[model samples]
Target: MAVKKIGIIMNGVTGRMGTNQHLVRSIVAIRQQGGVVLSNGDLIMPDPILVGRNEDKLQALAEKHGIERWSTNLEQCLADPHNVIYFDSQTTVRRAEAIRKAIKAGKHIYCEKPTATSLEESLELAQLAYEAGVKTGVVQDKLFLPGLLKLKRLIDSGFFGKILSVRMEFGYWVFEGDWQAGQRPSWNYRKEDGGGIIVDMFAHWRYVLDNLFGNVKSVSCLGVTHIPKRLDEQGHPYACTADDAAYATFELEGDIVVQANSSWAVRVNREDLLTIQVDGTEGSAVAGLRDCKVQHRVNTPKPVWNPDIENPFNFSEQWQTVPDNQNFDNGFKVQWELFLKHVVTDEPFIWNLLEGAKGTQLAELAIQSWDERRWIAVPELSLGVKQSDAVEASK
Candidate 1:
């Protein structure tokens, strides 16, 4: 029954993802639940100090959440020794600089991914954090999702024997802001702001594929800026310089192939905004954000090719829905809880800055592959190596 209050400096939390996922759903929800209980009966409570550029927004967020601490000055917050952890959810271009500053200030770092814009900077950050001996983590939220968790369970249970290939369909039509405002931030379509679907999504895909199926050996990608002209938040029209859509293929360690189509321009026709279908020798499963359906080889119906005759087979009826035997918490909250435990007790946290660097590497290579019109080999990243050494090793 010992309660330990961990002061966390939450920067850039005024943003949508930072506000909703990191602050409200995760940290605040954890506080509401009376903090995270350790195995040794100690309670780890997160005392978050909301930090942002705007004083009014920070004050409002703090007041709304009933939080005691709020600050517009990041350096002032970092200077305090009581704040042991620094969490960033800022724009991609700004992440590395802020994280570096935090690390220098002797704070454990946790933030959203594509940790940096380039492979070199990401690796450098990882190395710096490692040398500093401070705990670091990146948000791999999708791995904790109910559907993906169930899929992982199925994989573990040998439900899909001799796993073969994975196909992911993820997208939604984002309004152009002419008539209706875009669902995403205006910076998401601007290349100068480190915005693009390829960089944003490939970070998630790299971890998902590596953790779920196998290590990605190589990648081939095609990127497109489908919506060139889009209105900004101010209803002013601007030209989009970043890729809004991406069609990518990956080869895994087990020779398993993965095809992912990511776009903000495509309309949703599937089960959810994201759906991953895995086909294997013994069975197949299609998992959305919350639901998962599976079809074993024995249950799969045979359908012959017929160009002239009308198809009569009930294709959708053959699959069985995977039951929700266990109650699932919010994915972001789940990770946040784990991270809290890691911060308090010396718990094993595998998703470190090195892993985040690997994710950034994948995105960088995918973009290179698309630009060069060739398959890019995904080399293993080492935290111990220097930038030059790592570059040489990749060749």
Candidate 2:
């Protein structure tokens, strides 16, 4: 059996997402499973080279993971013929330059989302990758989540008849960086660092909505920076230039309205950091990060309308917890395996860079919409600088 030696260059291993999701859960998990086995008995073993600016950090990570290679020089790593895949989990502002370099180097790309800070740069990267003929993908990790998968199954099985609307509540109180230690990086609080809840979470929302409910045709959003100032990593106060929260509503193609509220300053009172409630004509389902619950109209609570006194609706009583199934499992690991399979067999993976670009486009347009206080029409992807050339080339 032929073993495909795929060299993966993983940038931003120093970050939380890079360390936990990409490295520990995905790459390390893949290696532990004795590599991914193809149907024809071939093996896809990822020879991942950790790439970052910090030598000490890289060395520590490499040693911790038993990984042989570590490099501070991204260009040098890209120059190597062995490193066929360039994966970036860097700062949103830095992603464009890094990915563009990787694409020009003829390496396939698999990177974290919101591909670029600006939609234009995202489009350019996608166009370049398309023209260069290299495989590209974005990490749409939520779709593979156990709870979300269960919800998808319920929907697929016709548990929810005709989908009506989706309400997503996502957030947790991110500590003020000044008074206390914050959960996320300090850069996430600064606009110049490409830090904003809208950009970060809306990209995830786009795919989730598109996959679960319907295609988003339009959106109206309101973003706010609740905490105007926060402490940096070194305990110095810094002005929070980016929005900490975003309340967005999407108009889908089927007239399905999806509303999402994302924030870093909200106190958690829900099932999880992320919870999605899908109400349909016949039934409804609520999905959290790890669990889901379903309620049919037959099972829905019968309530009398009384507005005089405290007549609060006890809707929780109506829903029944979704039973755990066999495949109710880890999401990050699941996507990682799928990616490895796609890499090995050239499988039909829809979550490509173009799809990623679409997410970026939506987020960018949403921000513009908020700032301009008007609806911004999402432009179709023109692969090149000119529309006519892109159309002809696409054809």
Candidate 3:
């Protein structure tokens, strides 16, 4: 019967993903739904203040969303006791500094990945948050995707009995700014700006492999920059220093082998921008962003090798589509709601800062593997700062 309003400082929301996914599709949509309903008939409404560098952009975004608060000064917003949560969608290079400030201000944290460009800094943030005793959550939105949800269902039902391997294909060709404007920001191709497909996509892959199939045991990755030069936002050509593509193979705890090819410089010729095909002993399934199709061992078609003539079997038509069993909300919004509940009543939220750090760790190792052209072992992470260490941090 009671409505509780919580304040959130949404930083770097003027960016593309920040504006569309986190702001419009998530926060704005949540407000439109009359806020997140908590158990015991209570409602939790988010009062978000959009914070960015540009005043005009922030003001325009706020006005468009029917929000009254927008701030150019993040410190000023962080100092306010009303704003209890800090959400960052800033560039990889800028995220840690802002998060450190927010943690110092004693605000709960939620943000997009990779949390830091390096594993050391990521671990430090996780440890700091633990010492501060602040509730934290990271964006593991892919796990909540409808297609992945169906894939999870299949895994749980023994449909893929004794799962073996997974093949993930993810990419879309980003236009160079010569004839057409690039789809992504220019910073995405600059190594100095914390940009690379390995760093970016390995973050997502780590949790997906860990949570769904098993914890990653080892990784062998190869990364490259396909496009040497690309036009920046202002049509100025700049040399690309970061890896635009990554081909990675992972060994999971249950002996599951996962192969992922992530790229920004390749053309798509698939059902979705991202698709994962899971093959197991009993059955196999292919899942995209919204759809999953499966073929059981009994139903799978076998064809004799005849490359001389056209194949007789309708390979694509063999699989059956997975039905949408229930209404699915936006993945980002769903995670946001869970974090809100966690902040409110200590709900069991698992995707904390350490999980985010794990993503960064995977990315770091992937890059290292690519550089060395060798398989790297992934050690289990159990991070906590001692009371004395926390005291030292204070001094």
Candidate 4:
């Protein structure tokens, strides 16, 4: 069996999500597992060069991971022909320019979500990559979560026949950093830095809804900045100009309604930090980050309405737990492996730049809907190259 080495220039991986999810849990773990095995018994090994603005942090991260390649010069790394792929996890405001540079350097691109702050710029990047004939992808990691996987299985098995509506409650209280440090980066609360829950999370909801339920037809949203001020990493106070919470309603292709409440100021009182409840004709399911519970029509308890008498039904006990029958890997790692395979073996990868642009479009419309206080119609995006055709063209 032969082994192939693929050099990846990993940019902005020193940040929290970049370091923990993409680098440590995904790429580094793949390296530790002897790389990805191909169908023909060949091995595709990843050689990552850590790139960031800070030399000391990049060097330390590289050394900690037993990696030898570390660079502070992004242009130099992009100029290197050996590095065929450029991966970015930079701040949202900085991603477009960096990705444009990488595309100009003739590198395949992969990166974290909300590819750009606006739909126009996102589509521009997608068009540029398509014209450049480079393999491109954007992160849609939530679809691979174990809980969502089980939900998909249920949907495929007809457990929730003729699904009607979906309710998603996703959020956790992020400290304002006056007394305690905030869990997320300070930039996440600043609009000038491309920060907002709608921009950050509505992109996720768009793909999740489109993939699992149906195409979104329209949207109505309300955005809020619950916390007016917060302390930054340097313990200095700053005004919070971005929306920390979003309450959005969506209408799907099949008349299925979806209501999602995403917030950073809400306390967690549910089974997990995130929970999705789907109600259908035959049954209903509530899936958290890791566990799923279901209540079928046959097993659902019936209770009589009595205002004067004591209620005796145990609401939470009626649902049955979904068993863990299969082993699940980290979501980020799974996508990383797929992307690596797509790059080397010309495998089909559906989550390309166009899909990323679609997500950006959803967020853009949602914000507009909120600002206008009216429903916004979601139009189908027309890409120059169909995604499936692009895959065929690559082959």
Candidate 5:
């Protein structure tokens, strides 16, 4: 069996998410596992060239990972004939321009979500990729998480009959860079730099809701800057121009009500940083990052409500943990392997740029709902009409 090496130009590797998840956990992990095996017994290995602005960081990352290639010249990397795919994990503001340049170079695209700051640019990139006839994909890593995977298995097994509603709680307290250093980049709190909880997180919510439950029909949302001022990387206080918290209610196709709260200021008191509770007529399930617990109708407890009397029911003990019968890999690495196979062996990859545009569409509608303080309908996204066209067409 032969091993084929597919050169990948991975940009924005110096950043936290880029460095930890995409590079180390995913790409490097895939390499260590002997790459992805193909249908024909051949293996397709991802040969990623780390591309970033910082030479020192790039060199250090490459050396630490035992990678041979690292470059600061994105243009030169794109120009190389050997590189078949261009992956970007840059800050949201810079992603569009860089992806456009890569598309112009006729390379396939794989990148992170909320593809662009606006719905117009997101759709534009989708349209451009369609015209260019190049394969494209966006990271939808949450779908591959072990907890969510177990949840999917339960759904498929008819454990949740007539599923009702989903409640999601996601977030943790990020330091303000005053006493302890901020865990997230300071740009995340600045609206000018394409930063906001709604824009950042709604992408994940859109895909998670659409893929597992149903397509979002409408949204009612409230966004707020809970902490108006936070210290920057330099420990200097700056006005937070973006929403630090978002409380959103989404209506899905089956009339499922999804209430999601995403915040960076909230303290952790739940089972995990991200937990999704799915309720149904027959059963219910609560899923965290790596574990899932479920309660069936037969095993569910009934408790009497008496405010004056002390409660005796152990609510948390009623559910049983889902077994990890099979080994689950890192979600990011799993997705990378799938994308690599899709590129080399023509495997089907459903999470394309258009699907990503749908995410951007949801985020935009949520923001609109927040601004208008009313429910906003999610219009079906198609190539028949563009956001830019509607502006001039109205006049």
Candidate 6:
């Protein structure tokens, strides 16, 4: 059988994630590997057209990747019947509008998380996609991280029986892009541009919690603007209008509590970029970005303290390193492969637009909780008539 060329209209291809992950690592890598081989022995080839607002940047990216198709006009590409997929890595503020345009053009959609600037807009996108009968997905990439996968396996095997509580610490001191050349975009520090630590990281936490531990029921959070001023893309000063750090606590349905700290102003002095500590009645484990270690009841330590003497609790020494049992691809690349497969084979990909809306709801609620100084309960996400019913009825 010949290859089925799936035309993908890739908006925001000139940006950070677009250039590095989607274009170079996924699409180009697939092309180099002779496309994606299906179970039927045929292949699904991705023909990506770089679309963005910057003509020069798009042209430069197209030339760099040997892509013949490049355009600044999104609607023009959307009108082309051959382009069946609309992919986006644009800013959060721009996603809903772009996606609505694509849905109007009758194209399947895939994009980054926090699908819109607000939860309402995110849910609207999900409903619109469902109404248009278009397949949609959002990036939920952390599930593919090797260490996290290992932790998942442990949880599945009941290594930590009767889970108690979980703690997570994730952050790095992101240098101001202007003076020190930061690792993140400058707009990430501005509220007008949909930038904040809580909005960005809590979206990730929502999925990670649901996928790994349990469903989040309620949340209490306090967001802070630790850095009042920062440098921009250019070597100039700008007042930061968004939160730099967030300390949040989530209560799961089954009496599980999760506390997470996300920040951009903190100096790194931790196990990894992200570390999750899980404790259960039987055992305890800590998983980092690339490593996980566990402590069992058999190896539990004991210590004592006296009023006249200093206490010694060397419990950290009792934990043993969990061995790596499998290899995993890059997180973004793994999700990209699944998205491609879903596009070609019509596989059930649950991380769709509705799931993205749930994450957005969590982020928005976290902000509301911060503002109101009260706990917020996340309302259930509804995608018009139930998605399963829509799919079966269509079939």
Compose the digit string of candidate 5's lDDT tens values, residues 47-131: 9999999999999999999899999999999999999999999998999999999899999999998899888888888888888
Compared with the true structure, what per-residue lDDT tens digits does model 4 show for residues 24-44?
Answer: 999999999999999999999
Q: Which stretches of candidate 2 lie over 4 Å from their true place?
A: 307-314, 382-395
Clash totals in order: 0, 1, 0, 0, 0, 0
Q: After superposition, how far is residue 144 of candidate 4 from its true place, in Å?
A: 0.6
TM-score of candidate 6 relative to the true fold: 0.93
Best by TM-score: 1
Model 3, stretches more than 4 Å misplaced? 385-395
Off by over 4 Å in 1: 392-395
lDDT of each: 0.93, 0.85, 0.92, 0.92, 0.91, 0.87
Clashes of 2: 1
| Candidate 5 wrongly placed segments (more than 4 Å) | 384-395
lDDT of candidate 3 at residue 322, scale 0 to 100: 99
Report the Cα lDDT for candidate 1. Answer: 0.93
Model 3 residue 132 lDDT score: 92
How should the candidates be ordered by TM-score, best one leading? Answer: 1, 5, 3, 4, 2, 6
The model with the greater lDDT, 2 or 5, is 5
User: Model 1: per-residue lDDT, tens digit, 1-395?
Assistant: 89999999999899999999999999999999999999989899999999989999999999999899999889999999999999999998999999999999999999999899988899899999999999998999999999999999999999988989999999999999998989999999999999999999999999999999999999999999999999999999999999999999999998899999999999988889999999999999999999999999999888999989898888888899999999999999999888888888879889999999888888888898998999989899987778877755543
Name the lDDT value of residue 15 in candidate 2: 92
Best by lDDT: 1
Lowest lDDT block of 10, candidate 4: 386-395
Deviation in angstroms for 162 in model 1?
A: 1.0
Looking at candidate 3, what is the lDDT of residue 366? 84
Residue 263 CA error for candidate 2 (Å)? Answer: 0.8
TM-scores of all models? 0.98, 0.94, 0.97, 0.96, 0.97, 0.93
Instruction: Report the lDDT tens digits of candidate 3 across residue range 268-339.
Output: 999999999999999999999999999999998888998999878888899999999999999999999999
lDDT of 5: 0.91
Candidate 6 structure quality by residue, lDDT tens digits, 184-225: 887899999999998898889999999888888999999999
Candidate 1 vs candidate 2: which has greater TM-score?
Answer: 1
